[model samples]
Each structure stands twice: as structure tokens, then as C-alpha cells.
Target: MQKIDIRTVDVIQYLQPLREGGSLPAIVKADDGFLYVLKFRGAGQGKMALIAEFMGGELARAIGLKVPELVFMNLDESFSKTQPDEEIQDLLKFSVGLNLGLHFLSSAITFDPLVTTVDGLTASKIVLLDSLISNIDRTDKNTNLLYWNKELWVIDNGASFYFHHNWPNWTEHLTRTFPLIKDHVLLKKADQLTEAAVEIKRLLTEDIIRDIVSSIPEDWLQSESETMSPADMKAAYMEYMTTKLSNIDLLVKEAADAR
Candidate 1:
């Protein structure tokens, strides 16, 4: 299992609002003098989005994928006063505590699968990772990829862990099959799904799976039910991921069948 240490930084300046998805992440300059795509804790999607971003990015990194460095960005209430947009002001005011940040890739262009061709091994690995995490946002409509400095970087995985949204019966859906992967943009290019499956199984060991879920901040694991504490939620996330590891073959076959 690989270890990850999350870096924290103070958001010194709000450069601009991204306003893309429901979360409405913003581009900001941190005290470290780097621009970051900051995902607010007060967004409609709540802290679950941040959990998905951190957990998904870390998993991608562990499997040798290109993902921007993630940081815990601190935003002060005073910072909201500087924004003229009333809506953004309210968002910042509510997200005054801790937020998740993705290192911004300046001038990076959105990847178009039709225009660019990816290698078989890399494509297969990416498909496998998305399946393992149950990421639903990597379809052709939204690639969630950026081409920076001649490399394809994966980004925006807040929609990966949908299971967290319905925690009450999460266990019943643990073995649920992901049939939507047929729409994955890279499915056609991933000719080595079988080989990728072996690699994914080797990389995502039980200990590695637990370590990944444990890295999530306890504060983000807000309980939706009285019986579910933050620690219990974290444990559930671990169990969910580790259990999903055994079902990768189903996902691979689904993608292969789609191809």
C-alpha cells in the first residue's frame, strides 16, 4: 500500500468562479502562489464531493495515473466580502472552513477522445480505475480530462462515489454491477481490459484499499443517520471499495461487451 500526505494551504485570493457543475468550484491563488481549482464544502453536493475528489485522485495516483496534486485549502469568511457576486459571496461565506483544491493546469485544453488517440494499456487502466470507483462522469459527453504539457490528466471525480449518497442500505448495493460503463469514452481504445484487470487487482490490495479510505478527513464523513458515525462511514467506504475489487471482472466484461 502506498502512503499519501495531503498538503494544506490558505486560499489567499479568489481568482474566479468556475461555475461549471453543481459544486461551482473556483480558481484561486493559495498562499503557496499556485492557482487551484477549489471545491467548496458548502456546495449543494456537500463534503461528499471533496471525499470523492481526494479518494479518487489518490487511487488514480496509486495506479500510475496523471492527476493534479490535491490540497486542503482554507477559506476565511472575510474573503467572501471581496466578491461582488452575491451568489458566490453566499457560497464562500458558507464554505468558510476547509475545502478541497486541485492544482490548476494553466492553459490546459479539455481532451477530445475523437481527436486524440490513447495507448491501449493506459486506456485500459483508466477504464478499470473508473469501474473500481464507479465513476459516472467519464462518458463521451464529459471526458473530465485535460491535456497539459503533452500528458492527459484525469480530473473532477466528485461523481464517482455515488453509493455514499444512499448510506442507509449501502451494503445491499455492494455487489451491484456497473452497466453504465458502456458509455465510457475510452472503452473502445482499451483493448487490453483483461491485462488491465490483472494490474488493478494487484495494485488495489486490501490494505491499500483501507489506506485510501482512511486518508479521507473524518470531518468530511458527516453522518446522514444517527447510527452512522464518521468512523463508521469511513469503515463503510473501505469495505465498499475493497469489496468492489473482486467485481472488476464484471465491469471489464461490461466495457468489453460495449466495445
Candidate 2:
């Protein structure tokens, strides 16, 4: 896999608020004249959520999953003053610097597995990728799958890589199996867990892993704890993910059992 680059885009307009999730991500128009579902760093989740969005979404796209383009959105402080809603204003105020943006799919509809038939191999790949990242947002209740341009597009991976929230104990959780596979929307649809595992392992090379980890902004990695600098935190993430990749067999087995 080639090294992936994270682009930085400036927000030109804040169109409207997407009231779907607790974080209150908004559909904002960027300078590129593209609409993006912007996940604010100032919202309830903070910088950890943005890191997960950057890392998890990239990993999904890296392994052949159809994820929208992920970019670093620049939000200016003045933009928040135009909003009348106190909640949104506070969110923008808090997220005045860098935020995560998901390229908005205008004509896409939510993917409901009951009405659509996803191939076994594709389903298995999605499940395996989600498991590797420990994503908890892709359940039936809110299947993050979007049917757009006649293909399924993965979105909103902010809930993944939750270990970053507790960096001190990230090592302990590195080898743990993702227990949420049982309720995964695609568990029954997937039958090629082993094949998917092989493909994932092959695609996630060491250089690719490093690029993903370093793709995160330096500001996001800042810690009040003097023990772990931003560079150390970045190394920690790379180490943790590479360890998880080696131990993916356990997760594959867990997914198979759930199926």
C-alpha cells in the first residue's frame, strides 16, 4: 500500500447542524467547495475522537473498504459567533482549531442490511476491519454504512480506537478481542473471516501503520502528563496497532464464533 496523506482544508461555511449523534457533527462547506460532515474536537468526545476518526477511517480505506475522504478541517473562532444555538456555538468555540471532516455524500442513504445483500467476502472484510480497530459505532441501530454511488461507503469511525483515551493502560487492551462483534450488523452476512484476515494483515504494512499514526496532528497528541510526549504517544499508537495486527487471529476467531 502507498503512503496516504491527510489533507488540510479550511472551512468556508457552516451550513447546518447534523442532529443525529451526541457530538452534534455539522455539515459544513469547505474552501474546496465540498460539503463535509465535520466532527468537532470541542464536542463531548474531544481530541481522542478526532484521532480515532483519522486513524480508523484511514485503516478502513487502506484495507479496501469504501470510506469517504478524511481530511483535517480548519475551524476559525469567528465562525462560531454566527451560530445562534448555544450548543453549536459552544461546540464551535471549543473546536476552534483542527477538526475531523468526512466528505459528505449528498445522495447516499443509510444502508440497511435487511433490504440489501452484501457479498460474504465484503461483509467479512468490514467486520474484520471494525474488529481490529475496536469500533463500537457500526451496530444495527446505527449502521454507519452509507449506500452511495451504488456502493457501500463506511463513515463515522470516531468511536473506534478507544484505547487512546486511557493511554497508560493501552498496552493491556492491545490483545483483547472486540466483544461487540456479536451485535455487528454484518456478522451473519460475513462468511470469509479467514480470507479477510489475510487481506488485512497483508495490507497493513509497517510503513503504512507509521503513516497512519503520524497522520494525526501534533496538537492532538499533546498531553498534560509529562511522562508521554506527543512523539511518544504517536509511537505508542503505532506500537499498539502493530501488536494488534499480529494478534488479529484472536479477533478473527471471536468473530467466527459470533457468526
The runs of at least 3 residues in candidate 2 whose Cα sits more than 4 Å from the true structure, single-residue gaps closed, are 225-227
List where candidate 1 sits over 4 angstroms from the true fold.
223-226
Which one wins on TM-score? Answer: 2
> Highest lDDT among the candidates is held by which one?
2
Could you give candidate 2's per-residue lDDT for residues 17-66 as a string of tens digits? 98988899999999999999999989887998898888888888888899
Per residue, candidate 1 scores C-alpha lDDT tens digits across 1-259 of: 3477889999998888886666788999999999999999989878888899889998888877899999999899898888899889999998998899999999999999988768898899888888878899998889998889988898999888888887888898689877778888888899999998898888777777677787787778865453689888888888888878888888888888888
lDDT of 2: 0.89
The superposed Cα distance between candidate 1 and the true structure at residue 100, in angstroms, equals: 0.3
lDDT of 1 at 253: 84
